[model samples]
Target: MYAPQADTRLLARALHAERITAGMDVLDVCTGSGALAVLASRLGARVSATDISWRAVMTARLNAARAGQRVQVRHGDLSMPWFGRTFDLVTSNPPYVPARDARPPTWGRSRAWDAGRDGRHVVDRICSHASALLRPRGVLLMVHSSLCDAGATLTRLEDAGLRASVTERARVPFGPVLTERLPWLRAQGLIGAEQDWEELVVIRAERS
Candidate 1:
């Protein structure tokens, strides 16, 4: 399971900032520990959460239970559990870190944050299918590393007829994963030779 980190906190801040009215239907995709899902419930929204990792699903469920929140935690790929159901809001902190391989890992802890090659493996999928999961005027809030091309994300969402833009951003020092892949990241022209920080962005896309 992916641990909640800066990206998670940032997304949570954005969630808290949102005026989530009571009974709003919220779905959190790739929910790690279900922190955001629980928070949504706390804000009076009915919540559901999904994660590719069974461990994460269980963890989220446990967390929600302990918090006395009613969150339906499910084990599934991003947004898969909610097919044919549209939500008022969808939030994700998906795998956006670039990895050496061209394909994402099918199993293991790395699946939580390893986006293959250009780091759009999961992001692109989210962009394409987001519209299907959103009710008209429903919103999607996603967070990822700027290294994965945030502009492309905006364009993709806009192309799908969603008004999208960066809602929040922050610069954080490289974590263990990025620090370990410095040479490769630099070689790929994803970061500056002397750079040690990465900018994380929260994108908000609204379906018309």
Candidate 2:
């Protein structure tokens, strides 16, 4: 059962809206079901997508077949050894939930949720590596949660020497984010322990 997540589904649509041109070498990290990869391919980018889950890899391939596009899908972490090279445009829609987040009953067991105790584990790691993974002047488009400290994310990218910017933001319905992420959220004074996941931001950064 493919569950439709706001971040996942919304990411593909946002990518389409970004008007990414043809022939761009795009890398979709944490590819999950490959929605972003397939969409980028349709826009004429040479796409390479990867995920940490086997099921996600299969789903991505299947979805690509249904969409009549070819995307190189691989089962791997943010980057694999064989994925040895870099790309012109790197994008990731990674898990932003902290460990306290109650595992969603819907999401099939995948590392796509709960980065670490802070929810920035994988997010920070991926953003930190973006510079090495991207070519000079390459771009990185990523979507994460305000639940994950959007400011810190931007700071990390900047620390990595990438000029970062918030391209979009939206308020969506998130039920458990308030309950499960409350402890950490309140610890950071991010949430009042009464607020849920209402806002998400799509970030765009470039390798300078």
lDDT of 1 by residue, 132-173 (tens): 999999999999999999999999999999999999999999
In the range 64-109, model 2's lDDT, one tens digit per residue, is 9999999998877677733568888887888777665444223456
lDDT of each: 0.94, 0.78
Using all chains and alpha carbons, the TM-scores for the candidates as numbered come to: 0.98, 0.86
Candidate 1 pairs with clashing backbones: none
Q: In model 1, which range of ten residues has the least summed lDDT?
A: 77-86
What are the per-model numbers of colliding residue pairs? 0, 0
Q: Report how far residue 38 has shifted in candidate 1, in Å.
A: 0.7
Query: Residue 192, candidate 2: how far off, in angstroms?
Result: 1.8
